[model samples]
Target: MNTKMLHDSICRRQSIQNDYERIKSSGSEANSDDDDHEPEVNVCRISAIGLFVNKFVEGCFLSMIMGRNILYPFFGIYLNAAGNSFNSIPAVFATIWATKIFSAIFSDALPLFGKRRLPYMVIGWIIAASFLFSACLHEYPEPYYGVTNCTRNTSLVLNPRASESAFFYVLSLSGALFGVGIATVATDALTVEYAKREPLKTRDKVLAYLNIAQFFGALFATILSGFGLNSTEYGGSWCTSYIDFEDILLIYGVLCVVCTFFTLTATHEFPVDPKKLMPIKDHLAGIWKTVQSSMFLKMAVYIFLSGCFADVQSSASVKIKAYYAGVQPITTGIVGALNSFLVIGSIVIFTKYFSNTDWRKVTIFIKINIILLTAFAQLITIFDVVRNQYFYLLADETSCTLFLGILIYIAINLSAELSNESQEATTYGLLATIRLLTNPISTAIGNSVSAPFDVVSNDRYIRDTKEDQWSIAYAIIATHVVNSVSVLTVYYFLPKNKFELNELKLQSTHSKKKGLVFVGVISVVFVLAITLIMLSAVPQTQCLQVVGGQGCSNKN
Candidate 1:
């Protein structure tokens, strides 16, 4: 019996030793795999690069739309006078904001058609390009650039009968605006989704690189278009009679289509299991929770005010044309291009060495500078307000653009930190919605307040004197002052180490239907207000330049 017991004990001890070795070996192998996961890391970077390319193309398209190049400015000058482009600014942005909201809402829900973001983006691009193509069919008459038809060699002037072409022209404009809205929303959401898949450290770098690419793309487009804006004397492709503006649309349209194809083919969707899809109720509940958060509300209001200030400043081209005559589109393009370059450089430097604490401090300083400098610039322009050098405007604009770029960088990072990975896109979309509303809201206010002063433009709107435009300038400056104060309030609510803190995961108890109804009511009311302004507000008549045998008049 003793011999048998001893043998069993030895066998049991040997078995235990073998089991321990196997467990130890498995853990060691796992640790080794974790340390040497180069393939996985490399794959993430490759995917990030693809997204970066997609954004670069988007940046180019946006630059073309926003740049003070011949195309966009001509479009503006045709629809309204170059000096009075701000007249219909409210309506244009109302459309954009409405479409953006729909696109952002639908982007998350559109996975039923296939990948959530890519398909919508492709469709949006197609729609946008198609509309631009249609706009190409009509050319801005000769009166837009100068009173004479030097290139076309005809007596044709900018049509006083815009009502004749208003229908189709407006249709094409709507399409472009809506298409841009949808495409922008989808692309923004996709970027957030892609970034979430990366580790935190890598994700920041990825966003930084992508933003750099975006600025580079904008810079490239601005430079390319600057040559075109300057092409008036040469009368080449950028000239009205040459490519006829229609072909330019075709060119950008085709570019968008081609880029869309490449983007669809190159980018991969982050895998989402069907079973993990949240029900509509849960999604609404989640959104409601986010909306109810005090921090988010404060941020939203701040963004709205900031956007108000930005819209006025973005209309600087009009202000420049009104104040400093002979500042041609080419000159505007040059300043815009310079601003883009400086913005890129500033972003690179800001990201390179700034810690979180440093970023917060720098962001505050930039915000203050943006407000003060913009107010000073507007006041100077308003009161005549001082006889300053030409470069003063450029310096102010460039500095503001630089500050804006830094704010965008910091804001994006702050947003990422505030939201969880699961709902990052939705959070961003909501924030963007608030920011976008400022466009129409501020423009409407500017239009209504200055209407009494008759600073609005007529068909042949020409800048007469600084006195005629000071009211409008003052209106814009006042908004900046208001925004400066409003924006400062947001900083207090921002927690310390916000970018490093965990997201606030709230228990959503708000009634989804009530929340939806509330949001709907707000949107409807805002849209109604904009429509009322558009219908009632009349464009103020201003004197026209007497040239090529045309006489100056009160109403064109």
Candidate 2:
């Protein structure tokens, strides 16, 4: 269902983090190596090029060459070939995002070229572009590379790629994710800094702007997927269909470079006032100060648990949509773009009409809407109601685009408010890390829970038997049942509104050890998910052999 970013600083950051804690506890300040360095010139400042400049850049990165959405089918199928389940795909890619905290830390402490985010943003894009270009030249398992270099190539279902080595394929993808990921984080970091300039009442506007940008990116990805790579099988016959997925990637590589260049020219990283600057150690220590607050801790827990609860989506949906339901790429693309448009519309409507509504109610409404809509869609899938492509958009994702568009901004607004202004990224990234870490844990739990129903992630669509349909349906529904439980918890975890948020007193009773527990949790999930994906060349799924399935093809 999802994939994500990676990190630049691993070893260096640990030493830095540990030192910050140690220094904080000992009540002494050691002169950091950069105490005497000249004040940063490029400085952290918003650009005159446009309103929501960072938002625009970040949005472009999301949909443009980033390929996070477009490549989902390809990599999900590829990972399935290598023994990863569809449920596990999001978690695995989420590891890249899990590195955001570290990337945030690297930006906060290291301060590349007297600046925090810009240097990394530019450099990260360069690396990502290189990998995208490199993937074009790499010889993937020829049989599984999709139908003749494009055309309904969303992961060759033949399972031929499973029998071959995926070393280079994984390497190239990883490199791109790592590069683009850190850059994306840096871009977000830039936005976070910019967000600090706004008052709480209007800060959500910045996030809303960013959300619109993402939807815009989604719109682009849809057109490309529908018109470009889609072949006759996926209902892409409307176009001539000349370019391959690689051609798309080649375009992305160029766009990545061009976009990074835009970042350089479009905005300047204004300097932080010297009076506001603190010792690097103090800044790191302040992460504790912010996250240790009872409100922030509660928020982190809610974010983790709500998101982590029921993420048991499997690849069976792909086959069902593509084969059983006969949904074509053009249909998918058209609806996807339309959904993005709806989300933008909803955001506008909400900001204009419901801006005064309690944030808590909005959060709860979104969760409930998610529960009902997703279940309704899945129910249609299970019962074969209509068996048409448009129903999926109308029943399932329609509300998603309408309601979920404002969520990222709300999340940013809430976390930004909780964070110390001086250590914005550190606090925000710490919270984002919790959300990131939840994907894998939730996926693992959801799939494991759904296992008893005999649902599977890599069910081959070529088989025609309907005997296993009920079990798969049951498994899918079970995930929704678990997800519905998350809505109840939000009332207790979140503050009523921004007023209550500002009123809550930060509790100093918490210690560094408790804070490290959160860090430890992050480390555990990151390592486990990465290890699972790394060992994926050997089968790790617990799929049962069903009527229409090739369970775990990588199994020896």
Candidate 3:
């Protein structure tokens, strides 16, 4: 059958099957004689082609994370060590961000080409791979620059400085192009297409699963960078020790290409006649209409602000590591994993309990609380009430930072969900655009805001120095305070309604009862285990330090 006919057939069969299942489960009995004469149930099956397409898309996602998260950091470190300034790093990233604007525009336009998603994805991947490969060879001396005349003979002299500059330019350009190809409009569109098959009730779960997959991909990248790049042991020579970085980039590029091919080969689109396809102008008009919605605008603002805060936090990662000189990359990876774990848990819980309630109120409340908590954390950090090591350890062990992160993440998720209930893909695309726009702006602001403090405090020179650490703390506090107030203002001015509280109460009670019982048993076991470990592990001086740190030395 033709593609349209096949789609119609599938739809009819699915509808009939659903109706039959509903009747069967409702305890309706069919006449015994009529049962034999009934039409055969045609099971709705996902085609082999469909499965292949899904897998291919998933693989591309996996590869993108590997390249962006895993390889990029190592590349950044290498470029920095090669005499590039800290400022240059942001410029490189900014270039990547700038390219995404073009990617977004192209992605939105590609469907007009009459080709399916696969061609766009394939071409993008090819571009990404080619640029990445060129980036790998960036350190090679330029032929023209190396040509020199010596005494009575023509000779070649390698200009290492010229080679370094050439390499940096190539690396930056490749990174920018890669960002344009893989991370922009195509990813958002793919995610929306995936979610279209799922019911609204399961949509959040589907997104959570995708996010989880992305997190796992990031985690894998972190591990690969730690081990493959030999970051700790071989800190020098981008071309030498960091060859694995290029290898990873190439691998991900190959995966992207292969997956794109699979997607093309396996997926078929039902051909829409010109009458059926939405006109380009109409679609653009719809985009404008969607953008003008008050809810969408509010959500867009909230996400932009939230992203600004998050960008600051992300930029602080290197600085955090600098504070703890002996900390390993593996430790950082573990912390990241812990954060993801907590975030996943929070999303699950929120979906289970708060989903049936009014998301708007819950989102607003959460944003307010996030601002409060962010401010509080910053205040504590600035006042020296929370030491960096202790804060990091607490964040690591108990997932405190993860908890806070999820509070903010859930707000953004709910806001996005609420803004475009009907046109989710477009809503999310806009949200992504807002977020992308904010990232570089926020990063630039954060770097600028943090610079004077760094210079004045001479934080780099001081090891184990508590005096100068307050500069960052103050910046964090100021930013969070501003963020909180802005959200509060938005919450106040926007519409308000009493969401049903009883369902939430019931869910809370149920969860609390179960959690209390579980925690009580676990607490006893945990106390015993900790006591045992402590008795075995502690020395007298260390015990005193631990006690003092806990503020229990005098209490006992």
* Predicted structure with the largest TM-score when compared to the true one: 2
Flag regions of model 3 displaced more than 4 Å: 1-116, 140-184, 233-244, 266-276, 313-317, 323-325, 357-401, 404-426, 456-459, 462-467, 470-476, 480-483, 486-556
lDDT per residue as tens, model 1, 199-255:
443455556667778887787676665555444432222354333345556766776
Between the candidate structures 2 and 3, which one is better when assessed by TM-score?
2
Candidate 2 local lDDT, residue 239? 34
Candidate 3 Cα lDDT to native: 0.43
lDDT of each: 0.55, 0.60, 0.43
Off by over 4 Å in 1: 1-50, 66-72, 75-87, 112-114, 139-158, 162-170, 231-244, 309-319, 322-325, 358-361, 378-393, 457-479, 494-497, 500-521, 528-533, 536-556
Candidate order by decreasing lDDT: 2, 1, 3
* Each model's total of backbone clashes: 2, 9, 0
TM-score, cand. 3:
0.61
Q: Write the per-residue lDDT of candidate 2 for residues 1-556, one digit (tens) a residue.
A: 1111111232245456556655654564443322222221112324423323434544544553333344433443323332224445455556665676777777766677778778877887798889989899865443343454445454555545443434455556567767767777777666666555444445566556666776676677677766675554334443354666567778767867776777787655656556666677877677766655666667877888777773445435554555456666666677777877887888877766766567777888888888888777766765666567778756766767677756654666677677766576677778777887777666665655555654443343444346566665666677678887788777778766554565563332565666677667767877876665544323443332321124456335
Which number leads on lDDT? 2
Better of 1 and 3 by TM-score: 1
